[model samples]
Target: MSILANPLYRPLFEILRSARNGIVYGGKLRFSHALVINLLYKSGPLLPRMKSVFEATKDHAQVLASFAIIYKIAVHFLQSDAVLGRKNLRLTKFLAGCFGSWIVYSGHFNLFNGGITHQITLYCFSRVLLALGKILLDKYLVCFQPSFINYQGDTMLYKNLNGHQQRKLKNLIYNKSWKYFAIITWGLVMFVYDYKPQYLQSSLRHSMTYIYDVEMDTWDTWREFLGI
Candidate 1:
């Protein structure tokens, strides 16, 4: 049987679908934000690697334009449920994982600088928040309705749960909203730091500098210290 057709695998499929959608949406937003920074501020000093890419290439504008097109194509591909079969789904998941790994590696290597690091961190945290929000929304807001239970294929799924059990589930999901709020607040703080690092207090700036040493400082110093 198809994965979605099997009751045992349906929940997994739903979770994967939600996660993929969140990632694609988050990535698209990040790319668009980068495009704006590249065009308007020229990546500024905050994102040194992006500035280097623009400076080192003669056709950097064309390259960025191509990247925008590619981002749109990726978003479309990820969103299209009708065209994605099981094999395609697995392949896409593998590709997404590889892309995520590359993003982490690039941040560590200072490929884009501290701003990129901040953006990557926030993007990841936000995606997780979004996935959890989707799950909770489906369970509490969508699935709790009598109409939803009636229309669902397996009546036993909801039939086994009493009112108290359903209320408990809703309460559990509702209580997790604080996590989503925290992620959003953290993302905003990162955004401010990316735009105006000097606005941060001296101690906080020092701590952030230490934390993002690879991205915020020169790699040559680290190499010299290591005697490489």
Candidate 2:
């Protein structure tokens, strides 16, 4: 029977589908990205610039498509039979992410001296960090309040804590976590951009400089004011 027809391998179809979609989507996105960057910074004949963009699209798209296929396969293959058909285990996901990334992204794309690969991986790293944070919030949450015990070794937390206080604290966290996270994220990026800009991607560093380092001189013209 086909892998899709078997219950044990129903996700094979999704893996294949992901691969196909990755090629198409990554190609389009990489092509646009390369083309835009070339238009902005490259000084060359149109034909040569288009040729360069095409070459970049090929390498970047290949890297993205390969990672998509490999990660999907790794996630499925690493699943244990005892917990099959459930959300992927964190340990399995960690192993699969590391191993698959090692296999598929071991080499860099040939765009801008492989800067495209750096950009992709850095973006993925940020996204994966946020995703894992969300997962931890959902599955591994803990109360920082110290547990009190009676003469016997039993947690008095439940007895001391009422449901309203529990709900209030949970509500406070749920409502305000994102606010603090956003502020801290911005602060960290600015800190890096200020003193350790070499740690940032070239495009990001350049963009930050444009935004933050440009002189606030008197406006010379209406065109300048209007950003024409």
Top candidate by lDDT: 2
TM-score of every prediction relative to native: 0.30, 0.62
**Model 1 bad stretches (over 4 Å):** 1-88, 100-105, 136-228
RMSD in order of candidates? 16.1, 6.9
- The sequence of per-residue lDDT tens digits that candidate 1 reaches over residues 121-180 is 455677787677768676655456542243345454443667875666556656677666
Relative to the true structure, candidate 1 reaches a TM of: 0.30
Task: Encode model 2's per-residue lDDT on 1-228: one tens digit a residue.
Answer: 875689776687788788888878878998998899789766879999999999888877777777777888888877857644346578777777787667666453322225766778778877777676665654543434545454576675533657775565446655587677789989999998888899887888887876788676567899986666
Candidate models: Cα lDDT each: 0.54, 0.73
Clashes in predicted model 1: 0
Candidate 2 global TM-score:
0.62
